[model samples]
Target: MSGGRHSWITFVSKVIPSLSLSLFGQVCGISGCFNILVGCGVPMRSINSFALIGMALSTFFTTLRSFSTATLQLKASKAFFLGFTNSIVSAPMVFFDSTTVGRIFTHAYIYIYVYITHLHTPTHTHIYMYIYTHTHICIHIYIYMYMYVCVYIYIYIYIYMYTYIYIYICMYVYY
Candidate 1:
């Protein structure tokens, strides 16, 4: 949010999530390799895509924090700061050619957050506590619920749907 080259630096900061995607790929690849050893034939491409999506997800928080930190330092020129950083970085990957798992993971990140935030769950939440510690106990509980339902349950669904979609496309279309 600087005036000159600083603006460019601002843009560069947005790409931090993309860098994270690189790390995500490495981590997911290792995990996938382990799964393969355990007798799963998950497509390598899907694993790559999933890791990138994870990178995108990690990017969202990074972008927000960066913005907050920048705001604190009081840099001027806030013309169109990067938003929803994870979605932005991961978008091309998703549109171009994401594995089913990758797609699911990316989508789930958004959905999981939404679903978890729904109803402001764990109604026993104490706002005063968060005011002091800057953390919400209820929110964390909701997030864990999201992980259990959205992540754990849906991984296999992603795999199965991708497999099914691929088969259907191949059998029904010549392309």
Candidate 2:
């Protein structure tokens, strides 16, 4: 009876935060994409100001969610490692034009940590865990690759449009 109760408590503590983080990631990803689209037509200065606020909020929520999950499920060292890994992995997104690979890599790093931690414990010793983790990683990689391709195409279009507009403005001003 006590064992079952403990299991239930563990499940609630772990699963709830995991689900929350997943939901937050989805929402932030969608919102960021929407903001990028809307900002294209607005003044760059105003859009950048608004985007700064939004990016701050997104970072705060992501950190909160990830920290909470790590603290809940992992040992102190592991939790720190997870947070550090995420920071390092996410850093490239600032310099890179596209985030699809960085995002997927972050997920893969977390999944790998999870797999390693699970293997260290006797209680979690199961073949299904291996299969489940690998399958999830594979699916995420495939999805992100497809999404990145589409994003690259959109970026190319945006660049071409901007170049065309710039050329037209230069000609009109000079003529």
Candidate 3:
């Protein structure tokens, strides 16, 4: 392919579908869980079971997406280094004669350093931060769900207690 255009096209093909699928899966799973938690229905056991399956599927798709993206990034970085090495090897003898080996290495080192700092470092950090925030959000959601269920349980208990007391008083007075 011309100028490695085909490789990029292939990378995109491998990446985009997984990315979209993962996003869709996550949305469906999260929404399903949310609905199961909030909606009125007595048969939550069945609905929650489905939501759990959806969430597991979502996690699987997300892992697949991450693996694809990582593989693509690895291929890209390898190509970059291969091209750099080829360029150095093909350079004219005169250029090497004029430039010291140290200077050549220094130049390559600087380029690679800058490239890694500008590209790889930020990407990894972004991924880490994104994962952190996502986990944090999930924890918060679980906490809220716990609190919501607890409140309802307490309310039901209180209602039952009061009803029992009222019935007992009525029976005692009538007797």
TM-score of each: 0.22, 0.27, 0.42
Task: Supply the global lDDT for candidate 2.
Answer: 0.50
Cα lDDT tens digits for candidate 3, 1-175:
2788888898799988878866764554454343233234434333345554554454444344444444454456457656766887888889888887557655665564445445544324533333333333443332233333334434443554455445434533543
Estimate the TM-score for candidate 3. 0.42
Residue pairs in clash, model 1: none
lDDT (Cα atoms) of all candidates against the true structure = 0.40, 0.50, 0.50
Task: Return the TM-score for candidate 2, rounded to 2 decimals.
Answer: 0.27
* Ranking 1 against 3 by lDDT, winner: 3
Error of 1 at 27 (Å): 23
Q: Model 2: per-residue lDDT, tens digit, 44-74?
A: 4333455556644544443444344333443
Candidate 2 stretches greater than 4 Å from native: 1-3, 39-175
RMSD of 2: 17.8
Task: Judge candidate 2 at residue 65 and give its lDDT.
Answer: 41
Clashes of each: 0, 0, 0
Query: 1-175 in candidate 1: lDDT tens per residue?
Result: 4478887787688777657755654554343333233224334433344544543444444333323333332222112212333555666655656455445445645563454345342321222222212223333333244233333323433454355445434533432
